[model samples]
Target: MINSNIGWEISKNEFYSENAFSKIFDAVVHRTIINVMAIYKKHIRQIRHFIVCSMGILLLASSCSILPFGEVLFSNSESVSTQPTGTIFYDDFSSTTSGWDRSETDLGGADYMDGSYHILIDEKNTDYFSTLYRNYSDIGLQVDARRIDGPYDNNFGLICRYQDEKNFYAGMISSDGYFGIFKIENGEYKILGHDTMVFSELISAGDTGNRIKLDCYQDFLFLYVNDSLLDVQQDKTFGSGDVGLIAGSFEVSGVHIMFDNFYLTDITQTMNQEKQQ
Candidate 1:
């Protein structure tokens, strides 16, 4: 009976030892799995942070490209001109170094010159100018201009009473050439007047300079190129406001044009009242 009891106790002890070993092995495996899961979670968090940072950098770069880099000048009420009894709108091309806004057809793919705010149009594409005014009525407008470079068709003029891209009045002078006044109605250029006294041709192919003057009063329109009188046409088609610059293509080289002196006055008033003394 004592031996049997001793054998039973040994059997019980061996069973308990195996059970304890199995429990310890299970605990080790569970702990290793938990540690590996924690490491994987940490790696995922790092990847997420990297992806977010990359997205932020891309967004910042895109924003910088879309916005314009320059200063814009709005209307200055204090800078109003009192002379010529009119207002002068001047853009010295200081702030707006990038050309003004206009149509592609009118712009004609002109290139920008370095260190200057003027658009350079070559003979290949001379029909490019800034559209200054549109849709205005009943005022005498004058512009002060200086010639920079000539040769080709350095003819600078005004587009008046413009109804669209096709219809308007044009008064222009060629460098060392004659003055021309024409009306464009229904997409046709009709000559109103031409004076060769100042210049033999519409555009002088030399380096001589010229000044042009235009006056629109009631139904009477007068144009002067240099010292020669070009046209005195009467037309009631256009009644008022806004003027623009005119340019054309024909072996035309680029020009540096500066417009400063502006005189606009109400001509309906008496001569004594309109005259500036």
Candidate 2:
């Protein structure tokens, strides 16, 4: 269901320039999109009828205005001690000058709208991201995200150690209450320590915002939702690169998500308290 002809259009025009890194990242993203499309073609045959019907609904919905703001229904009471004291980067996305991409196309769009970082993917089985053009290693990232529109079956989360799109780690949660940690190395996507996304009751499903936290330090990775730790994984493939927010669609499109209160800090400690228990 991916639109093969549509290119990755971020909000900033400079990103599509002939810059070497941009070229590499763009290629890697397109490759990932193609691979996901192949997967749907292979495994989604049984649901073809369902997809056809869903597409009709999505098309009609897309014709209307998409609201990127909603009521915040959840809070993270988790101890902030797990995050290091040093703030590497933070953005409330209240200004357009924050340097995140803001572009719109026939496929989708990523922009600073309604005082929040908004990402709308109108293409099925497609992923789009708006990254902070900076690099870091062993960091902690936290954000509040919620589904503004589109299917409940969608993906939205944080990415770390993004080295040229091909090598990176993604910790994601679906609006329908599934979560997973993934690694993309050399353009191949693999879930770390799992076969597929695991169901998690901790995630605030549907239109409610869920506080998400991800820590990438040394060889360990941690994913937290709504103040509760969901998964802890280990990997040594990627160590440092850019970081960002990602949103994608599964069987259906129009996966509109808005992110706010993004804070990035150094990773100073492990989940020792949870481990000892």
Candidate 3:
């Protein structure tokens, strides 16, 4: 009996040891699997990060290639000088009597009055006015005008770097409809783009007047109306020259107009330097 009991006890001890060894082996395998999964998850995250960064870089490079550098156009390096080099191409009726010349077209009943200018348009009379400024670059041109008489289709705007009456860059707003940037290529003013608000309306002479601002840089042009940005364009055709104003035709009767606050500058270098600071 004693021998049998001792044998039974030894057998139990051996079975328990084998079970403990099996459990330990399974635990080690499970820990190894967990460690491997963690490594795989870390690798996946790294790969995703790399892909996203690559895409961002490519997108940025593409954008840079398409759009002109803002710094080059609106740089702070250029300085605004008090001494004006560019002439005030024209004004309705100025107190200084500087570089403006007054001339009349076949259009009758056109005259200057109340510190403003007026032009009459008819079948026989198609009134037109023009002026020229010399030796100016990089300037902002502004004019305030209102239609006091005539149909809604009366037309007026500023012409910059004008090679002639028909060959130049014209920023015009029509009382009839449409305001846009235009270029006179072969004696015809080609409409580049038109503002939706102005385009949808049927503007006529003696309609509402608006403030127009034109900024010309090296290869860039911007137009603003009523202190708001209306349009921007890139043209290397005419960079620096004279500026002028136009009023006439395309409408029955005529319209009265006024202009003021004419300014010009060559602060291209000064504007660029200021940007860095």
Candidate 4:
């Protein structure tokens, strides 16, 4: 489960009870039909409304085929996710940020203060620090993060498959409504799936807490925030390496961010142990 947190745990029975598809189809049909009818009514005098009406009929037909009246794709007995079986390592950060040893700060630093990990970026300069607790080949890592101080124009999230501070994969979310996954090779940064950064409704804005998760299974990487799957892509740059956290400044310095409740589950190790047992 790439934690693309996008999965329906609702059983097929529950799905119908919820009437999700009907609600969606109703809204789409009503709005689309209304707009098409308005256009047809207006253009009827000029005989152009026929094209509009034809389109509306085609749209209605396609919409019916898109989901049909009542058809559920996935159904299950319990809340579900396609998660790999593994041993999970968890830290609520109640004690220290000690094992997060490697740091590269330009004008920023990561601290464990008042029982939470904080990344404070100075306005004087802009940079990020990579804090690695441990490394794994196929793994899933996630952390709870929110802004504590500084401007909303900052970026903070998880860094995984880290070959080093220079070369690694970064999954980043900004307070200004932007999210992206980047491949940093030899200190050069490039977007993974698309050339441009993206904005997502799945991402919470402002002071809201976000649980950013990155899943690394083989060469495929998936991004999930607040339990919603947002992005996915495949790459073959690096395999097994250290995983950690990162924060950077954008508009101003002194960007304060706090992270807690971290989880790192090693799929590789778990699989090996299971074989022996």
Provide backbone clash counts, one per model.
6, 2, 29, 6
Give candidate 2 misplaced runs (Cα > 4 Å).
1-85, 269-277
lDDT of 3: 0.44
Error of 1 at 27 (Å): 80
lDDT tens per residue, model 4, 64-143: 11111123212212222234355376666566534643221223445555555666665422434444536688888888
For TM-score, the strongest prediction is: 2
Cα lDDT tens digits, model 2, 33-136, are: 22221112222321110011111123222321232334542233323334335667777777888877655544576767656778887777777776677898
Cα deviation of 72 in candidate 1 (Å)? Answer: 21
TM-score of each: 0.52, 0.71, 0.56, 0.63
**lDDT values of the candidates?**
0.40, 0.66, 0.44, 0.57
State the weakest 10-residue window (summed lDDT) of model 4: 45-54
lDDT of 4 at 53: 12
lDDT of 1: 0.40
Q: Model 2 Cα RMSD, Å?
A: 10.4
**Candidate 3 residue-wise lDDT at 12:** 33
For candidate 1, give the lDDT of residue 148.
Answer: 50
- Count: clashes, candidate 3: 29
The candidate scoring highest on lDDT is 2
RMSD of each: 32.9, 10.4, 32.7, 22.8
